[model samples]
Target: MKLLSRAFATAVAAGAAAALVSLTGTVGATAAGSGTAAAPALTQVADEAPGYAVEDFAYPDADRILAEQGIVLKRGDGHITLAACGSETGLLEVWARSKDKVCFRVSGNGGYLSLEIPSVYGVKGNAYATEVTMTVEDEEKSFDIAKNTWTPVGESADPNGRDHMLVEIRATR
Candidate 1:
C-alpha cells in the first residue's frame, strides 16, 4: 500500500510538470510574436468588462414632460411616476393654477417625488397616506393630505392666501 501511494504521487507530480512546461511554451511563443492566438492582456480584458450600473433616480423623459406639460419633475425613487389625468382611477391628482390637473401613479410600499408646479391649490390623494411640501417666498410649508380624498394645499390652505409652488410629495401605504 505504501509503494502504491508513492507511485500515484509521482505520477501526479509528473503530470503537473508536463502541464507547466506546455503552458510556458505556449506563453513564450505568443510573447515572441508566434502566429498562435494569444491570451488577452490584463488591461484589454479589464477594458472589455461590463461597466457597473448606477441609478441616479432622475425622472425619465423629464425634459419632454416639462416642455409639454410645464411640470418640472426632478427625481424620485421610481415608486412614483407621472400619469395622465383620468387615465385611471386611484391616481394622486394635483390641481395647479398654471396648468390643467396633473396626476401621478404611486406603487410599492411608499414613494417620494420632487417636482415643481406653481400655484398648486389642491391634491386628491390615493389609497396611501400622502403629504406635500410647498414654498411661498422663502417660507416652506408641509401639508398632510387626507387619504382617498381631495385636500386643500399650497395657496388654498395658506392663511395669507399666497401663491405657493408645490415642490415635493410623499406617500406611504
Candidate 2:
C-alpha cells in the first residue's frame, strides 16, 4: 500500500485503486477509504501479515508531523505495522474497516477514572472494552469493563480522572 499524507484526502486517484492505499489524516472522513493503482484501499493498519512495526506521532500539525513525544505500535496482534502513528492521542490505532476509539488519561490523586482502548478490545488481545486498573488514595480498585471501562471519560466526580495520561502500546511482546 502507498502510505501518504493529508494531501491524499483531496487527490483524485489517477488509475484504478488496485495497488497502494492513501491516507487523508482525517479519520472517519471521506478519503479514509480510497485506493490507488498501486494497491488496494487500506483495510487496516496492516494487511494480513506478521512482522515488527513502529510508529511515532506528535501533536497535530497542518503540515507533516513534526517532533513527536510519543510512539505506538503492535508488537503482536499478527499484523505488521507499516505506518505507525496518527493524531495527538499518541495511541497508534491498529485496525482497518472498523472505526476504533481509544481513550487515554493518567491519575495523580483519583476518585474514579476511565481507561479505554483506541481500538476494539476484549475480543482476543485487542478488544476495545478491555479492563482498567485503578489505584486511588493508594487503594487498589477494579471497574468492570461492561459498565465503566468502555466510557472514555466520566461525568460525575464520584471518581477522579487521569492526570499524567500516556496512551501507548499496552505491552511490547
- Candidate achieving the largest lDDT: 1
Cα-lDDT of candidate 1:
0.90
In model 2, where do residues sit more than 4 Å from their true spots? Answer: 1-67, 70-129, 147-173
Clashes of 1: 0
- For model 2 the local lDDT of residue 37 reads 29
Worst window of 10 by summed lDDT in candidate 2: 106-115
How accurate locally, in lDDT, is each candidate?
A: 0.90, 0.30
